[model samples]
Target: MGLAAASSEHAPVAACGFAEATAVLRRLTADDLERVNETILDRMRSRAPMIPELAGHLLRAGGKRIRPMLTLAAARLFGYRGLEHVKLAAAVELIHGATLLHDDVVDGSALRRGAQTANVIWGNKESVLVGDYIFSRAFELMVSAGDLKVLQILSAASGVIAEGEVLQLSTQNNLDATFEMYLAVIEAKTAALFAAAAEAGAVIAGCSEEDAEALRRYGADLGVAYQLVDDALDYSGAEDALGKRVGDDFREGKMTLPVVLALARAEGEETAFWRRVIAEGRQDADDFDRARAIMRRAGAIEDTIGCARRYAETALASLQDVRGAKDEACLRALADLAAASTRRSN
Candidate 1:
């Protein structure tokens, strides 16, 4: 999903928690993030001007930089003072950026972070090639970090993300997609990177295997909550705040969690309506409103948010045995951010 800022007018007060948590993380990682940004810009340079231009367009666009922050925070939590985490953080961001470029092309999306997507500005072929270039850069960064375990974690995550994307394509417009299937798709597509980011940070820090595993679980749970919230927001969020039209998932005929939940509760006519709109791709303008009404009646959105909160709780719990006061606070705030993601209007 495209990164979006909460609109002042449309965003709920509860959503402010995410902003606050993000601010906390940003403050904590400001210096390292600066270095990460520099590394990103440095790596984006090439003999071909368009290579930097196209990648820079999206890189300079605003985002919370949450994944890389997780990397830095994870390393710091374990008392790592080395510079390897900086390169690793940049690599994490490059991996994320590569996914976004390729994802926009795959989703046929035009907007990202309230701006025209790289694919829209540079064409799909250029976007794809540049994405490949960025992926290569990410691997280079990993090698520069000189950590075999870190490389293995990230490389495996990259493969899992690709598999998740393919799985999502297979499930698209298939209304019968189960909740378990949806969970598996998101776990692969989103959580793998998060898990790897945190785990690699711990590896770089030379933390205990158990501590590293805890951080990995924390990141994975956080990522699942984040994606579930995004899925819910597509049906309920403000257009400007979401950075794309509301109900885009519906338009795309993707069977996200809310749809999966609603389908499980649908009656005869409701079942037919979903089948016609989602499975058949025969939606009309009013269909989105009707779908929203049905989802509300079924409490699908609320249930999805509840599910997100559960994962957020699990994420927080995963950090319960961590050793530092400051690190613990930041990790808890990140968990709160995960909960707030579902509470957002954007």
Candidate 2:
């Protein structure tokens, strides 16, 4: 799964809603985000020249920084006024950035965020080492925040994310890979960080255990929905909108939900096609288009979108139980963001 977008069939309000909701979150947290950005730059300094260079290549590449924004919003939603959330938020983003660096190395990706990947420019070893450096820096920031539970959440998420990456690598190109397997990979690799980011902010804000748990679930569900959209977009997404090559997952023989569903539904020659192209990894130039056609015919992509919508709905619901802050506007914005996440085009 990579950069996600709404399918053309559901293009109108889904895309617009996502943009507007994201903007609301941005507007709400703009001041703190500025501080978080400054902290990110300030903390990244080091004696090693290549450290900053390799790290900045991707860091400055313009990611949405949504995870950190969640941290900021979660803190403010509880009326906590302190600077620790800033450190925690920055740490969340650094953790995400470090993961991306490592993911590019593992996936051998050439492009990210519409730019050449750091691994492509700096080489795999350099990218990996810098990713480690960034991880260390993230831990440093987490420690500086002085919250043990927050540390536990973020650190445990890091380990789970690593395990998820390994699990995905192990399942690649395996026709036997089930929907359960794919979900496990994504839940760990992607959802864990989202969970930790939101929960960490709430914990730092001193929210009750119940509210903290709710935010955690909210983040996890949103992450799953987001990754599901990413998987669908790998086949059907526009290249300009996705900021990366479409069909890269197919080329890599990843066992995403779409492929799993298509394979499950395939019969006769279609089964053979999936076997050859997916399990055997023998794709030609036209294979991707053919795969897309097959998924479309099988309702695999549509069902994947439908599945993502369900999770996004659950994410929205998770936030409902929480007692809203005085303004309650942030609650609406967060709900809107979760509701529209399944329709993201970038």
Candidate 3:
């Protein structure tokens, strides 16, 4: 569905660009985010020195803190006044950091967010161990929150993320990978944490079960849109904009949505070319360019963006029943941000 035009009362702020939405959220939750950041630093400390060293490396690396910000923003939307959301937001950041460390090791990635990956500098063993340490810290914070429901949501998300990773491993280079399979993998790998973060926020705020569920659905759809855009960017985005080289997924033979779509539209020789390069891992220097050309010919990137747009619309719709004018407006801005994220260059 096309975005509804904002009424005149909201016209000045109606164009909820990603940066503007983030700015609004930051303004609304500045003090809370400060506490969350402080908590993250304190909890990341360990006598093991290397643990802190490695964990701090990625923590200091520039990420938008979007996931944790979601938690903070969601809590604010419900007028939560207690300090529990602070710990929960920090826990969400820890969980996200741990996943990044582990994901680098699994992907054998050399760079992240325009910096050397912890695994690249510290070695795989250190990366894995440090990731585990951070995960433990996350759970400790969750326990400190003393909310059993929060624990259940986050812990389950952790497991689902692992399962998603393993599922992606199983599907790698498999040309026969289907759209449903890709969606399932992204839901588990990426959306699960987002769902947990938003749900935990609403739960802590004492929102009704229905409202909490709406936040969870919003997060899940937003995450899928985010990942779809990321995947498309891997093939088409500038290196500086992406914080990594373009075609990284193509180089790794990962079966992203664009590749899946391109393969589906491949003709005789084009089919053989994809199978040889992807399934057989026979890529050459020129293969990435060729892959891009084919994907463009198939309109894969546009199709992927279209898919992301649909999810973004769904995310916006999920917030319809949310109460409170201010809360609904903030949530609507967030949903708009998710949709706008798909169109960003970086």
Candidate 4:
């Protein structure tokens, strides 16, 4: 998994190397990501004043832009030189931004990107409406890309994302949630877009189906790894370092992987505690702390991180057959990113 797999061996793949890999990828694709940003700004403009104002607040927020960068990197891997990749990359970002807006409203989140969420500042109704607006803009950008296959991939991913969120809603507050159910939630709600983002770029680059599938699998595994770490971080991460409240998922009764594993390992009194706090949604101020302590004792968080590392390794393996990549550094960074993503503090 070297240049053949994106510097998988060239860089440190330890959990502590996540930030280093992220910075490397950012520096490598700074120019392409900037163009994607420009397209996002251009496409977000609307006659309604509130639309730009609200959209700008979130778009200007300091997100990692990993999804869009996946699109750009896949395109560059296949030596794509056209502006179509830019449009698709911006569309990917728009899709992510729209999801965040909607998710904040659904989760009743107060903070995002270390700032007040749009839903907190503009109201849930406004946030939801603007999320719809952002979705429309993303579709517009996809259509402008004029690649029917890419459109199909992204539109299908969008639908799957919606379906995943609904499935998560159904599973919320259920102490009986299983590992399969949780994996389905993260794969669809998170990994589907990552798969589509990478595949879309390959399609635009006119790559072979094999290479396209490789990138898709790479993104899929990397996305799962990243999301698993995200869920684990909810219980273990620093609020300031993670850019949000640490226990939002617990308060919201999200049946994330860590919760699933912890509940599976619960004893008699532990089961009742989880039922009260998670199943019945009667969390007191100390519930989150108790939940974290329980998870640590059960090694749920450690197992979740370990699982994430396995997925990241799979992501690196998926890149084994990709060919015609012009920049070995981009590929190497991606492999390292997959390895390091599981260890993210955020």
Which structure among the candidates has the greatest TM-score? 4
Model 2: worst 10 consecutive residues (lDDT sum): 1-10
**Clash number for candidate 4:** 3
Clashing pairs in 2: none
Off by over 4 Å in 4: 1-16
At residue 224, what lDDT does model 3 achieve? 94
lDDT of 2 by residue, 1-346 (tens): 0001221225322334677888999999999999999999888899998987887778889888889998998898888899999999999999999999999998899998789999999899999899999999999999999999999999999999999999999889999999999999999999999989899988999988988998999999999998999999999899988889888899999999999999999977999999899899999989999999999999999999999999998987788767534335566667778889877776
lDDT of 1 by residue, 1-346 (tens): 0011221226422345676777877898899999999999999999999999998998888877989998998898777889999999999999999999999999889888789999888999999999999999999998999999999999999999999999999889998799999999999999999999988988899988887898899889989988998899998888898877678789889989999999999976999999999999998879999999999999999999899889987876676544432354455455556556555555
Question: Global lDDT of each model?
Answer: 0.85, 0.88, 0.84, 0.89
Ranking by lDDT: 4, 2, 1, 3
- Which numbered prediction scores highest in lDDT against the true structure? 4
lDDT of 4 by residue, 103-216 (tens): 999999999879999998889999999999999999999999999999999999999999999999989998878899999999999999999999998889998888899899
Instruction: Please give the distance, in angstroms, between residue 12's alpha carbon in candidate 3 and its true position after superposition.
Output: 10
Q: Looking at model 3, which ten-residue stretch has the lowest summed lDDT?
A: 1-10
Better of 2 and 4 by TM-score: 4
lDDT of 4: 0.89
- The Cα RMSD of model 4 versus the native structure comes to 1.8
Off by over 4 Å in 1: 1-16, 323-332, 338-341
Task: Find the 10 residues in a row with the least total lDDT in model 4.
Answer: 1-10
RMSD of 3: 2.7
| Residue-by-residue lDDT tens digits, candidate 3, 1-346 | 1123332335432445666767767776789889988998899778898987898899989887888888888887777879998999999999899989998998889988899999889999999999998889999998999999888988999899989999998889899899999999999999998888888998888887887898899889988988998899998888998887788788788899999999999977999999998898899899998999999999999999999989977887776656532364556556556657666676
